[model samples]
Target: MAIAWSGSLDFTVERSGKSLMGSAVSGEGLVNVYQGSGKVLLAPVG
Candidate 1:
């Protein structure tokens, strides 16, 4: 699998205890996740 974004962007990813959250931009659209723990969240912008 692959994630691609156009141009350039800066983002911060934070993890507390067992949770993770971040915001990112992809060629297809916006990508984000909040309060995620112990697993992977894959969202396809396309």
Candidate 2:
């Protein structure tokens, strides 16, 4: 099953030698994720 979440996150995904690497942050000034499996991250738009 897929979970849904909403919040503000600063994430960056990039390719590193044929691999993908990135960082994501949540709960920063109304940034939160709900109903997510933790691995899944969702951000809100205004």
Top model number, TM-score? 1
Note the residue pairs that clash in candidate 1: none
After superposition on all CA atoms, what RMSD does each candidate show versus the true structure? 14.1, 12.1
lDDT for residue 32 in candidate 2, whole number 0-100: 32
The stretch of ten residues in a row with the least summed lDDT in candidate 2 is 19-28
Evaluated at residue 35, the lDDT of candidate 2 is 43
| Model 1 lDDT, residue 14, Cα | 40
Q: What is residue 1's positional error in candidate 1, in angstroms?
A: 8.8
Lowest lDDT sum, 10 consecutive residues, model 1, at 19-28
Candidate 2 per-residue C-alpha lDDT over 10-43 given as tens digits, one digit per residue, 9 for 90 to 100: 3333333332222223222222323423355346
Winner by lDDT: 1
Tens digits of per-residue lDDT, candidate 1, 1-46, equal 2253323334334432332332222223343433423434346765
